[model samples]
Target: MQASQASSRLGQSRTSIGTPAAPRAERFRLTGPSVRLDPRIYAVRKDIADIALADRVFAPHYAEAEQARVAVPSVALREGPSDDARAVSQLLFGEGFAVIDSEGGWAWGYGLHDHYVGYLPAAVLGDMGAEPDHVVRAASALVFADADIKSPVVATLPMGSRFAATAEGAFLRAENGFIHSRHAGAIAAAEQDVVAVAERLLGQPYRWGGRGGDGVDCSGLVQTAFALCGLAVPRDTDQQAEAIGEEIADGAALRRGDLIFFPGHVGLMADGETLVHANAHWMAVVREPLADVIARLQPEHEKPVLSRRRVLP
Candidate 1:
């Protein structure tokens, strides 16, 4: 949609995320004066019904002027084809993301984390990459705009370089003998059609409420991952478990993307056999055999097993 047209729609429309619902067809008219988003400049999953649901769907500038950094050494990656919301960019750090874009259930934002600067699904952000300075582990890889891992020559990534963030696909789902864990902090990559994205972040840093490339949490990790894959995830473990539509019996045929929860914490499994997440004990992201981790965490609660809901894209 043209900016002028979008503005006109914003002026005429009244909407919100938590408002009462209308028939989905009455939402927006792309052919009308209502501002439709630019497919080239920004895009959400086509399955999304409306763009007017957001206050601001896309913009050339950051909605608010702010400087933020990745607080954690590693955070969730989102799903975006553009530089704005591609896997992991540094732009989300303390950047003021506008609610201009939409992808069905998700919204988009812009930030310094994404040097390319554009709209992305809003759901990928962990509290909008809220930050100051980001945390970086000793051996960290900071991906920049002009990055080329396939290239033979590239500058060495310094330990502390701020890049832009694009999107967070899905929560990391982990498994143990009969338990599931989704370590959002352990996620490394997204947008790839993998069975388990959480296992990819095995050995990432551990940061609390830290959703940057620096550090992240169990819930943050899960929410971040699903955002990239165009999945909407909640920020807390309990809330996340409820989003799973499919539930596996304790010992059912275990697979990837299954969530594992503990009494006070949660994590994700990369595969039926291995789990991934950051830990205060491990001090970083790691993958443990599902059966072993379950045995360790199971003894804590009378039945520490809370609820397992399957939330996948």
Candidate 2:
């Protein structure tokens, strides 16, 4: 009999092989802020698996993972483990990440502050140390090897970078070097007027993935301002719209510190009637009457305001 005919006959006889063939392998979906995977029942990538049992691999839960601190001035979090990969976000100095796994010269992990996951160059990370006592508040601040401002600059810290410090007469001593005290603020301190932080970046050119003083995006402005105030927020508009704070039911209720979200943009409420944002429209950070912004963008976006989230309250 042909193989197909023989299989048909075997199917008719219920009882058969030494043991019933095992059920088809099952796959479970695993997701995080920056990755998604369908891991099979018996096999899981080391980067996504938490532990390996005798016959199966377990997904990473991040419950007791090791932590590392970003030691460089800034590092790019890329989508893949390569230098040419697209950068999804940037980590300022002193930001922390939960080390999930390491491969080649990259570390796959999640940001401790925003829970953003991606790969960071391994050389930029360091063992966790004392918590930061002060944060660099200037758009960019220069660190000197000595307290003297004339000394050769050591490192240029981006706004929102934090470090352990002790105040000298006019400078703050950090592990790397001495930074002018005026450029630093107590870590526990928060800017009550978040809008004021946004105002300082008035002419900064807009960049799609920028998060520093020289250039920034809409969500970057909001994120950097909040960071100066010791509040942790995510990097993108969608995440910010959903996760930052409570929603305001009325548009008139919007106030300073309230984050206004549009289709794919975000801005901070400067006052009862003003909105401030790093906009590509203006190609720079600008403040405008809330009503004007609403009227102009509403027609284009099909709606003026998507939602208003009160991040402070």
Candidate 3:
């Protein structure tokens, strides 16, 4: 009749089960030989049944943050809206939870918590604490793997810069290994996520080493924030440009979040014709007319206009 009643009835006539008691035991643990229950109380009763069988149940007031310390390891963190971004990152998948689960291509998670629910793959979760709402300054390279603070070119981070998440092998053991890194982290990222997440930081700030929303740079701005949100965009605009979608030669057809790029620089297309970026040349993060930004920085024919990223499900 009702959902609970149906469950109770189904639990009783589990002919497929090896024993009559097995169905009840599988669904719940509260009811005993002498007990029967109203259908409305089936779920509550079942919970008690499971607990009675277990060695222990959770403390009534256990903190979510504490509980999160042991949540099902984050098996995946992919890009796109909460619908179709199911593609997985091979290296970083199944790494374990770093911080809270926020939003995804298909679903949104708690600020920094996970449940017993199995929703997506291992690519969705970033390394522990790699993605934090609040940020701290980087004294050294924040070395994660084989790296030291002396080589800023390797990690590409300046001293006293703030960052979001650091992986163990991604940033330190760089494939190119030419871009000298002062800090070495094992942050294994998808490389394409930097541009995707960095687009969110447009109009923020162009701090030399600042990575959070407070301030960011051409490369640091893109690389760090994406890691915080469980995406991994590249460190530079050129390499990142390749990762995004086709070129938007004209700003008229550009979408809201489309990214615009210039020689050695990048910005985002905001509203009708606004470009958002932390302009080092201008010394502040602000919005400009799309036409003007393109005319000033980009070439007439090859003006890097639209670099759309498909990050939603």
lDDT values, one for every candidate: 0.43, 0.73, 0.38
What clash count goes with each model? Answer: 80, 0, 53
On the 0 to 100 scale, the lDDT of residue 15 in model 2 is 20
Off by over 4 Å in 1: 1-91, 94-196
**TM-score list, all predictions:** 0.44, 0.77, 0.34
Question: Who wins the lDDT comparison?
Answer: 2
lDDT by residue (tens digit), candidate 3, 183-293: 322233222333344454445556653334245665455445445444556545766687645655543466655666666777655555776676786666666787776
lDDT of 1: 0.43
lDDT at position 77, candidate 3: 28
- In terms of TM-score, how similar is model 3 to the real structure? 0.34
Per-model C-alpha RMSD: 14.9, 11.3, 16.4
1-313: candidate 1 lDDT, tens digit per residue: 3322232232222243233433431232222243465342243223331243223343221122222333233333344534445443333323344443444644443343222233444444444342322211223342322322343322222222223332233211111000001222212333443224444455668765444355656765665556555465555566566654467676675566767776666767676677676566676767778677667767775765665545553
Q: Local error of candidate 3 at 251, Å?
A: 7.5
lDDT head-to-head 1 vs 2, winner:
2
